[model samples]
Target: MSPVIETNGLVKRYGRFTAVDHVNLSVEKGEVFGLLGPNGSGKTTTILLLLGLTEPTEGEVRVNGLDPLRQPLAVKSRVGYLPDQVGFYDAMTARENLAYTARLAGLRGTDAAGRIITALSRVRLADVADKRVGTFSRGMRQRLGLAEVILKNADIAILDEPTGGLDPQATQELLELIGSLAHEGMTIVLSSHLLSMVQAVCHRVALFNRGRIGLTGRVSDLTSAVLGGAYEVEVEASGADVPAVLGGAEHVTGIAVAGPGLWRVDADADVRPQIARRIVEAGGALKNMSIRRTTLDEVYVRYFQETKNQQEKKDAEAA
Candidate 1:
């Protein structure tokens, strides 16, 4: 099947500064795709281009096989967007706010009323459907925004910073809701800078850096590609020579001192047995040892660190 969204050599520039530079992306249908990056990294710019809110200086974009630039209305009809700061009439009830949205989308009467109730129930706000939106918390507002999307019966949902400023409980609830959406066959495009949050909900992610995509793939794939391993072992041992001894163990790709007696070891496989034996041979008292799959946070940090190092090398050579 063709991608639900595709962009080729997408670029946007203001003056001499490019906001999005030569980005090529493809998002499949029914999957949650994440645009991961810090602020000013061009994630929002790319979204605007996709939505036809802004025209790209150069490149091609197709949203569900239609050109967003030339067919914006058609694209808007099928796409729902929830901005970082979701807006609503504070005095209006939850159902009232969604009813207003439904009218704007040309929905009314029984059709609109049924959708309002169903959307509210899907987002778990059915009981509070009549409560004023002004009394709703930040998390509640976010879910309400999502309800608006569901009410539209949109094929694609683009959420910008959906969980930003949400507390732990709220974030978890929102993430679960997002997962359920994808499970029910809605294509979701999530944009956020929180590495761990993106890892929790996104099936695949594109890491943005300085108007460019540094890497794009499944989190586990990126972890192995960037860190040179998929397994990370945390070793807590006491001895002056422990680091040196562990560094030489087979299958160990890299090791970093995490704390006074804690070292994070990156390896290709589960080398806990080898690591344990090495610590004993070196006479290091092992306090603790644990292993788990490498996380996106580590992959993100290591990928950018490598990019910085390469740029520095080229600058030194130029000098």
Candidate 2:
């Protein structure tokens, strides 16, 4: 099946500066696709290009089989966007904001009213519907922004750091909304710095850095392969040279000194009992051992650190 959103070697430039450089993406229908990147890594630029907010400088782009560049209005009509910093009239009430956006989204008369009420209710903003946006907290405003987007009943939603300033409760609510939308087969593309949140919500994810895609794959497969379900075992000993001993162990992949008299060894698989016996036989006292799954944050840091090192090496070579 053709992808819901596809970009081949997409590039975007502003004057002499390139914002998105030869980035590629593919998102399936109903899938929650994520762009994971730090600030200024071109996540927003890529979104803009995909949503027809900005023209790409190079390569082909398509959104749901339509050329967004040629039919921007068509794309925008079916797409909803919630920017990182949403702009709204501070004096307007939540109801008022949603009502206005709903009308502008092409809903009319009774349809607009129904959409406004449904959206506000979905975000639990009905009680605060009459409250002025200026007085609303950051989390409240984030909820309002979410309401505004769905009011249009868009097919594709593009959210840039959608959970910014939201508390745990609000973030969870937003995540649930995304999952609900996906269950209805709504295509979603979002950029997030929240690794755990994305890992929980997104079916497909891409790691972006320096205007390029560093990695893209199914979140489960990506993480499982990276982790290999390894366990960490720490031992205490005096000058036992744990690394040397573990280096000879067939199942041990890595060993490092974590602290004075503490050694951390990475096992290929969970073999805590075997490792304990080996340590005792080698005269190394087993202080503590714990199994830890490699979290999304750990994977992100590892990959992004590699990206930064490579970029630094390029800069050094240029110099």
Candidate 3:
């Protein structure tokens, strides 16, 4: 099947400023795909382009095999978007707010009513169905937005910062709800600043940096590939020349003392046994040693830092 969403060298610019630059991405059906970046990195702008809310300066976008630029109505009908800042009739009840949207979507009477109820129940907002939206908490508001998306019966859902400021419990609840939606066969495109949430829920992610995709892949694969499948061993030993002992060992790339008696070793593969042996051979009294896999957060930070460094070098050379 074709990708549920596809962009080819997508570019969106505001005159001299390029908000999205040569982005090529494809999101499959029934998967939670994440777009992660700091603010103003063009994550939102990319969504806009996909939705045809803003036309791209160059390249192309397609939703469900139909061009969004040419077939906007069809694309809009199949896709539901919940932006970072969602709004509702403040004085209206949750049910009322949803009803209004359902009506706008051309759903009405019993059909609309049933969908609204189901959507509210799905988000665990059924209890507050009749409560005024103005009285709802931020978390509750977020859930209401999800309910609105469900009520649309959209085949694809694009959520921007869905867990932005929610507390732990609420964040967990929202993520669980999103996962359930994916299981029900909805293609979900989630954009957020929360790395942990993205890691927990998304099947794959594209990391945006300076209006471009710096990295893209499964979180685990990206983490491994970005760090060259590296692992770190944290060793605690008394008299061990741990650094010198493992400095030139097979697969050992580098070593450094972390604290008074703690040393960290970076390796391309599993060298736990060798690390232990070298420490013991050097007559170092080993206290403890633990190997840890690289994390998505670490990979994200390193990629952006490296990209920034490269840009700085080019700037300096030109100067």
Candidate 4:
């Protein structure tokens, strides 16, 4: 099947500045795809282009195989968007807010009312359906925004920073709701700078850097490609030659001293046994040793750092 959303060499510019540069992205049906980057790194611009809210300076975009630029109304009818700062009438009740949205979408009467209730229930906001939005917490407001999307019965949902500023409990609830949406076969395009949350909910992610995608793939794939390993063994040992001894172990790809007597080892496979045995043989006192999968946070940092270094080297060579 064709991708629900696809962009090719997408570019958007404002005066002399390029917001999105030569971006080629594809989001499959029923999968949660994440767009991750720091603020002002082109994520929002890309979303705007995809939503037909802004015209791209160059390149192409298709939503469900239809040109968003040419068939904007069709695309808009099928795609739902929840912006970072969703707004509603302060005095309006939650259900009322969604009712207004329904009317705007051409839904009416019994059908609209039924969808509103279902949407509220899906986002777990049914109990607060009659509460004024002004009285709702930030998390509740976010859920209400999602409810509006659900009411549209959109084929795709684009959520920008959905969990931003939310507390741990709220974030978890929102993430669970997002997961359920994907499970029910809604294509989701999530944009956020929160690496951990993206890692938690996204099936695949594209890492944006300076208006371009730096990397795109699953977290584990990116971890292996950028960090040289998928497993990280953290070792806390007291010995002058700890680094040297651990470095000699087979499959040890990289090692960094996290702090005094603390070292993080990256390896392709589980090497905790090798690490423990090597430390013991080296007469090092092992305070603690643990192994776990590498995280997106680590991959993001290392990938960008490496990209920066490579660019610096190229500039130096040119000069």
lDDT of each: 0.93, 0.81, 0.89, 0.92
How much lDDT does candidate 1 score?
0.93
1 or 2: which has the higher lDDT? 1
Q: What are the models' TM-scores?
A: 0.92, 0.89, 0.93, 0.94
Q: How many backbone collisions does model 4 have?
A: 0
- Please, what are the lDDT tens digits per residue for candidate 1 over residues 166-244? 9999999999999998899999999998998889889899999999999999988898889989999999988746668
RMSD of each: 2.2, 2.5, 1.9, 1.8
Q: What TM-score would you give candidate 2 relative to the actual structure?
A: 0.89
Off by over 4 Å in 3: 247-261, 267-270
Candidate 3: residue pairs that collide: none
Give candidate 1 regions above 4 Å deviation: 236-250, 257-263, 281-287
Model 3 residue-pair collision total:
0
Q: If both were scored by lDDT, which would come out higher, candidate 1 or candidate 3? A: 1
Number of backbone-clashing residue pairs for each candidate, in the order shown: 0, 0, 0, 0
Please, what are the lDDT tens digits per residue for candidate 4 over residues 100-174? 999989999999999999999989899999999999999999999999988999999999999999999999999
